[model samples]
Target: MTTMTAPAQRFREFRMPDVGEGLTEAEILKWYVAVGDTVTDGQVICEVETAKAAVELPIPYDGVVSEIRFGEGTTVDVGTPIIVVDAGGDGAAGSADSGGSAGSAGVAASEPPAVQTPAPEAPPAEPKRQAVLVGYGVAPSATTRRPRKQAAPDVPAPDVPTADVPTAAVPAQAAELNGHDRAAAVDRPLAKPPVRKLAKELGIDLATVVPTGPNGVVTREDIRAAAAPPAALPPVTAAPEPLAATAGARETRIPIKGVRKATAQAMVTSAFTAPHVTEFVTFDITRTMKLVQELKEDRAFTGVRVGPLLLVAKALLVALKRHPEANAAWDEAAQEIVHKSYVNLGIAAATPRGLIVPNIKDAHDKTLPELAAALGELVATARDGKTSPAAMQGGTVTITNVGVFGVDTGTPILNPGESAILAFGAIKLQPWVHKGKVKPRQVTTLALSFDHRLVDGELGSRVLADVAAILEQPKRLLTWG
Candidate 1:
C-alpha cells in the first residue's frame, strides 16, 4: 500500500535572555510550566535568581511546551536554548493527520508517489518582550547573542609542573589575595570576591574551609562555619574530646548570594575607594518625636508605620535640598563631581536575605505622607525578599536608622557612588538643655559620613546641621520645602 505522511513538525526554541543588566548567567530558581503545558506570550514560564535579585522570565510565544532543557536549581547562561515548544500544531493532531493521510494515500495511489503535506514552519522567533524588571530593560531582541571576545593565540606550555606554583607572582592573583604578600588560593578553593572578603574579614583561611556551593566553591556560610569557635575546648586532663557534635552542627552556613553578595562588594568598594570623613551631632528631636506620635494618631496614618525614621528620612531630604553638594558622587575615572539635582533617597532595610538599601525614587518630590508610604512599602518588600534590584540603584543619598537597634550612633559607611549616608541613632528621654533649662527631652545622635573628595568638611557639617535643624523644628519642612 502507498501512504502519504504528514509533514515534519517544526519546534521553536526559546533561549535564556539576559534578565538583569548584563548578567551573564542566572540560576533557574523554579519552573512554572512543564512539558505538554500550553503557554502564551508574555506569560512567566520560570523564575531565575541572578546575582542581583530573583527575576521571573516570561515565555515569548504561544505554544505547547515540547521540552525543558534545564531543571530547577541549574545555572543557565544567557543566549542558551532553555525551552522548546511546538508552535504550529498539537502533536496529537500532527500524528492523526499523518496516520489518516498515510492510509488514504497508500490505498488511492500505488503507482505515483503519495502526496506529502508540508508542515508550516513556525515564524521566526521574536525576542520575548518582558515586563519592566528593575535595572533591566526589555531585551531589544531575545534571539540575539552577546558578542564574544576573540580567542587569544595559544602559547606553548611551560615544561615545569605549575600545580604547586605560587600565584603570588601574578599581579591579578596578588590583588585577589588582598595584598602582595599573600598567595592566591587558586589550587585550594574557589570563592567569589565578596566571599573571599568575608573570609578575610573573619580571619578564616579559605584553604581550610569546606566548600558547599555548586562546583566546590567556598561560600560565605562555609567561611563563617569555619570561623565558628569549637563548641568547647578539650579539658587539659582529657584526650581532645572527640570532635563535638555541636562543632559543625551548631553552625549554619547561609551562602552569600544575591543581595548580600552585591551589598558586600559595594560596601568594600565604598570603604576603600573613598576617603570617608564622618561628623557626629547629638541633638534634641523632641518636636520630631511629637510629630511622629501625632501622625500615628491621625486618621491619615492609620495602618501605616509612623516612626522616628520617617522624620529622619524627611529631614535628610530637606538637608540635601539645602546642601546639594552632600548629594553627589566622586567620579574618579571622569575626575568630575556628579552633583545630582534630584534626590533618590535610599532607606537601608535589614531584610532576611541581607541588608538592602532600596531608594525611594525622587524623594525630593514626594510629600511627607507619600514619602512615608514609599518607605513603608520599600521596607515591607525588602522584608519579603521581593525588592527588585532596580529599586536599589540610583540613590543620591541614604539614611540608615540604626536607632531602631537601640544604638546611640555609628560612623556609617558611605554607599558606593553616593557622597553621604546619615546614621540615625536611638532617641532616648534624656536630660537636655531646652531653652537654657535642663529637662527630660527626646534626644538622639546623628552621624553623617561623606566621601571627602566630593564633600568637604564644611559641606558635610552644613548638611548634618541642616538635618539636625529640621528635626529640631518640624515646621521647617513646610517653609524649607
Candidate 2:
C-alpha cells in the first residue's frame, strides 16, 4: 500500500536586516502586526529606531506570525529575529541581497486556496547581505527566540457574506489583513501619523474638519489650515478650557530606556572621564564647491556622489598625517596613547530618534572615488538604519556634518574614546573679500572638539586650520594629499 504521508511543515526565521550605519540593535517602537496575524511579503510589519532614523521594517515572507522575540522599547543587538511568520510550506525566507534589502518574492503559487508545501529534501541557502552592523555579533543564530501565542488559532470559518454587503466585498481576504480594524476610523478621513499626532497635539478633531486630499487624507498643510479654523480668527481661544489647561499639567514622563537611556549613560561616562576642549573656525568654502562640481563631472567619479563633505573628510585625513596625535586615542588604563596609521572616519548623522555616528574604515587612504562612495554609503546606510556595530567602532576620528541643516558652525563633543571630532557647517553664498574685493562666494564654518588632556589647543588648532586651509584653497588639497 503506497499511502504517502505529508511531509512535516518546515519554517525559516528571517533575522533583522542591517538597517544602515553599523547599528547593533534597534528598539521596536511600534508593532504593525500581532501573533497569528497574516502578513504579505514587503508589507511593513513594525517601526524600529536606529541611531539615525525610525524605519518601518517589512516582512520578507508572507505568512501568519508565530512569535515576536523583543517587545516595544527593547533595543536588541543585530541578528535577533524579532518576528516570526509562517511563510507557507516551502517558500524560503533568509538573508537579502547585498543592498541590505530583503527581496524574496515568495512563491506566488503558494497563495490562494492552496497552502505552501515544503519539499522534504532541501539545502540550507543563506541570503546575500548588503550593509554591515556594528557592536553586534557577526553571525546570527538560525533558530528563532521562542514561539508565542499569537491572538489565537484563527477559526477556519467557511466563506460567508454579511447582510446587505455583496459577495465581492469580503474579498477572500486573509484573517489578519492590516488596517481591517482601522478601516472604519480611517474611512471618514485620513492623515499621516505625524499629521495625526499634530492634530492630536493641537486639540483638533480630525473627523470634524473638512479634508482636502485625493483620498481625503489630511496633509500637513491641511492640519495647519485646520489649526487656523477661520481665516481671520486664531485657532486657539483666549480662555483656557479644563482639558487644554490640564493637558500640560499632567507631567508625561518617558522612562530613560533603549537608545535614549544608552546614549545618556555613554555621554555621561565620556564627558566625566575625558577632559574636553572645543574650538571653531569660520572659512569661505567657495573653492570647495567649485572643486566638488568638477569632480561630479569627471569620468573618474562617474557613479560617485560629490559633495562638500567629501572635501572636508579628505582634508581631515591629510591633517591627521601632519598631526598624528589628533588621530590617536587616549587609553587611560593602559597609560599609553595608541597612534593608528589608518584612519576610520566617523560621521555623526541625526536620525528621527537621536544621533548615530557610523564610520568609514581606512578612509585616509581611499581615492576621491573611493572616498565619495564610502561617504555616500555611510550617510545612506545611517539614514536607512542599517549600519553595523563593527563598522561604527574602531573610529580614530569623526566628522559631524551639521552644515546640511543650515547651521553656520557648532562645537561638537568628541565621540567617546576618540581624541578629536569635527563639525562641518552649511555652505552659503555670502559677500566675502576675495583678492581684496567684495565678492559673492560660498562660505562655511568648522568646529573641532578634542580631549584637552591628550590634544592641546595648539595641536587641535593646527589640525583644524590645516583642514580649513585645504577647503579655502581647493588646489592645496591636491598638493597636500
Candidate 3:
C-alpha cells in the first residue's frame, strides 16, 4: 500500500530586541501584522516605545504569522519571544486533499510534534540564532525577578464569641471587611507596573481601590476615581443635577511616563548636581535682525530657514570656539575637567511629547547655510516625534529659545553633563541708546548659565560678552568666526 506523508513544519520565533542603550523593557505601541498574514524580511512589523524614544522593529525573515504573544500596549521584557512564524509548512490545500486514511495518519504524525513543542520551556539542545535588525539585538540573558519578602506569620485572633461565624471562615470575613478576598489580602495586588506607579503617585492604596478591568485587574481610571473626593449632595429643595456633569470635572491626572518622565528626572539631576551661575546681558540685536532679513532673501540660503535662532546658534558656536573651556563636562567620578575641542550645539525643541534637545554635530565646522539647514532638519524631526536617542547624546553646549514664547529673559538650567546653556529672550522694538542717541531698536536679553565648577565668573562673563558682541555687530561673525 502507498502511504501519503506530510512535510515537517518549521517555526521561527522573534524576540523583543533592546532598541535603546540597555533598555530592559518596551511598551508595544502597535502591531502591523496579525496571525495568518504573510510578512517578508525587513518589513516593519511593530513599533515600541522605550524610555528614550519610539522605535519601529522590522521582521528579519519571511513567513506567515502563526501567533503574537503579546497584545498592543503591553510592556514586554527584552529577549522574550513576541511572535511566532510558520516558515516551512504545507499549504492548507495539502490538508484538504488528504483522504480519510491520510488524514488519520497526518493527525498521528502531528501528536509527536505537539508533544515536542513544550521543549521550549526547557533548554534547547542547540541554540538557534537568526538575523536581527541593525543597531539592536536580542539580549541572551532572561529577566530575573527579585525574591518576594516572606510574609509575617498570621497571629491568632483573640478569643471572641461569634455564634453565626464559623472559626474557619473568620479570616475570610476579616479580608472582606478590608475590601479584598482572603487570597488577595495576603498576596500583592493585581495591577500592571504603570498602574502601580500611578497609584503610588496619587497616594491611593491599591487594596482599597475597586478594580474595574479585565480579569479583576486595577486600572489607571480606577485609581483616579478612588482619589477623587466624594461629591457633596444637593439639598432636597434644590433641583437635581445630572451625574455625568460633575464626574471628573475638577481635576485630571496625567500618568507621567515616556519623554516627560525622562525629562523631569534629567532636570532634577542637573539642578541639584551642578552649581549653576547665570549671567544676563541685554543688548541691541538690531544688526542681527537686519542680517536675518538679508539672509532670508539671499540666494545661498534659499529653501533653508533663516531666523534669529539660527544666528543665535551661530553666535553660540563662535563663542564656544573662543572659549573652549565652556564647551566641556565635569567628570565627577574621575574628579577632573574634560574639555571638548568640537562643539555639538544642542537646540532645545519643545514638542507635544515634551522638551527634547537634539544637537547639531560639529556645529563649529559648519558654515552659516549648513548650520541653518541642520537646524531646520532637527526642528522638523523633533516635531514629528522621530528623533532617535543617538541624536540627543554627547552634546557639549545647549541653547533654549524662550523668546519663541514671547517671554523676556529668564535663567535657564544647564543640561546634564554639559557645561553651559544659553537662553535667548524675546526681540522687541524697545527704546535703546544706540550710537549715543535714544531710538527704537530691536533688542533682546541673553542669559548664560554655566557650571561654576568648570567655568568661573570671569570665564562665564567672557563667553556671554562674546555672544552679545557678535549679535550687536553682526560683522564680527566674519572676523571672529
Candidate 4:
C-alpha cells in the first residue's frame, strides 16, 4: 500500500542582530512590512533604537513573510527573532498548496519556538547567517507576538490629531473596542498629520485645496505656491514694519525650557555680541542636481540618500580646506580667534522645539554618501527631540537650509561659536541668461554671513564665490578634492 507523505519545507526567522554597540535592548520604531508580505533577503524590514541612535534592520531570509513578531515601539533585545519567514518554502503562506505549513524551523507539536525576550539570556541558536538592516552583524531566534495593551482604566489618552491617523490605524475591529471615536485629529480641509503640522507652522489652513503628492499629500512646493501664488494682485507700495507690531490685547504663552529655550538664549547672545556682516551670491546649480540624480541610482548610495544639500555641504568643507580662517570661532574672553583645523559641519534644522544646529563630527573626513547618512540620522533625531547636547557643539561652520521653505534667500544670523554660516535658497526653474541666451534653468540664491571682526569682504566674498563655483561646476568637487 502506498503511504501519503508530507512536502519538505523550510522556515526562517530574523532576530535582532549584534549592532556592536554593546546595547542590551532596542526600541522598534517602525516596521516597513507586515506578516504575509513577500520580501527578499536584505530588504529593510524594521528600524530599531540603540542608545546612540535608531537604525534600520534588514531581513535575513528570502521568502514569503509569515509572521511579524514585534509591533511598532516595542523594545527588543539582541538575539531575539523579530520576524519569521518561510524561506525556500512555496510562495503561499500556510496554504494547502504551500507544503502544508510545516517547514524545517516550523514549531514542533512538542516544543514551540520561543518568542523574543529581553530577559533570561539563553545562548542564541539561530539559522544560517544573514545580514542585518543597518550594516550590523548576524542574528537568529524565533518570534512570538505579544498581546495588545489595554490603556489603564483612569488615565485619559491624549487626543490624537486627525491628520496623524492613517488608514492603517483604523483596524477592521476598532468598532468592537469600546466606542472609541475616530474623529479626525485635524479639522482642516484635508491633509496628513505631517502636512497639518507644516501648515500650522506656516500658519496655513487645509481649506486651500492644492495637492502636491498622491492622495493629497502637500509637498514643500505646494506650501510655497500657496504663500505666493502666481497671477495674483499687484505689489503693494507700502512695506510692513520690521518684525511686525506685537499684539496688545491678545495674550500667548510658551514655556521656556528644553531645546527652544537653549536656542533662544544662544541666538540672543550671538546676535548682540558678534559683529555680523552678510553677503549674497546666487548660482545656477543645474549640473549639481544632475549629479545627485546619478548618485541616487548607484547601489552603494541606495540606502543612503544623496540630495542637493549634501553637495552644498561638500562645497563648504572644500572651501574651508582652502581657507582655514573661515572655520574659526570668536573668542571674547581670550581676545583671540580660535581657528579649528577640523570641520564639524553643522546643519541648522528647525524642529518643533525650534532651531537646533547639530553637527557631524569630523565631517570633512567622511565621504559624500557617509555625510548624507549622518545628515539623515541627525535630522530625524532632531525632529523626534532625541538629539543630545554633545551633538550640538564643537561646530566650526554652519549651513541653514532656508530653501526648504522655498525662500529665495535671507540674511541669516550667525550661529553661536561659528564665524561663517551659508544659506542655500530655493531651487526653481527660472529665466537665466545662459550662454548669452535667456533660458529656463534650475536656479537658486546663496547667502553667506561672517563675523566682520574677523572676515573682511575679500575673504567672505572668496568663500561664497568658491561655493557658487562648485555648484556651477559639480565635477570640480572631485578635481578639487
Q: Which candidate's TM-score is highest?
A: 3
For candidate 2, write residues 328-442 as lDDT tens digits: 7888889998878889989888754457777898898898789999898888877766655556678778888888888888877677888888988888888999999999988
RMSD of each: 12.3, 15.7, 10.8, 17.6
Q: Residue 469 of model 1: what lDDT?
A: 92
For model 3 the local lDDT of residue 151 reads: 15
Please give the ranking of all candidate structures by lDDT, highest first, separated by commas. 3, 1, 4, 2
TM-score, predicted candidate 2 vs. hidden true structure? 0.57
User: lDDT tens digits, residues 62-181, model 4?
Assistant: 788877877986766565667777776343333434454454224433233331222334423333545553343454334322221222224222333332333223322222223233
Q: 1-481, model 3: which lDDT tens digit per residue?
A: 5344444445667788877665667778889999999988788899887666777888876789988989998878666578877876543345546666566456656676752333424432333454443433542222221111111124223332322222322322432333344434335456666678889999899989887765366877688778776552222212324433567655433556677887898899999999999999999999999999999999999999999999999988888888888888999999999998999899999988788888999999999999999999999999987888888889999999999999999888988999999999999999999889999999999999999999999999999999999999989999999
Q: Give the TM-score of candidate 4.
A: 0.50
User: Between 1 and 3, whose lDDT is larger?
Assistant: 3
- For model 1, the local distance difference test gives 0.73
For candidate 2, the per-residue lDDT at 361 reads: 88
Separately for all candidates shown, the number of backbone clashes (residues 3 or more apart, or on different chains) is 1, 27, 0, 6
Q: Which model, 1 or 4, shows the larger TM-score?
A: 1
Candidate with better TM-score, 1 vs 3 = 3
**Deviation in angstroms for 430 in model 4?**
0.6
lDDT of each: 0.73, 0.68, 0.77, 0.70
Least accurate stretch of 10 residues (summed lDDT) in model 2? 160-169
Ranking by TM-score: 3, 1, 2, 4
lDDT of 1 by residue, 368-470 (tens): 7888898899988888767776888888888899988899999998888888888999989999998889999989999999888998999888989989999
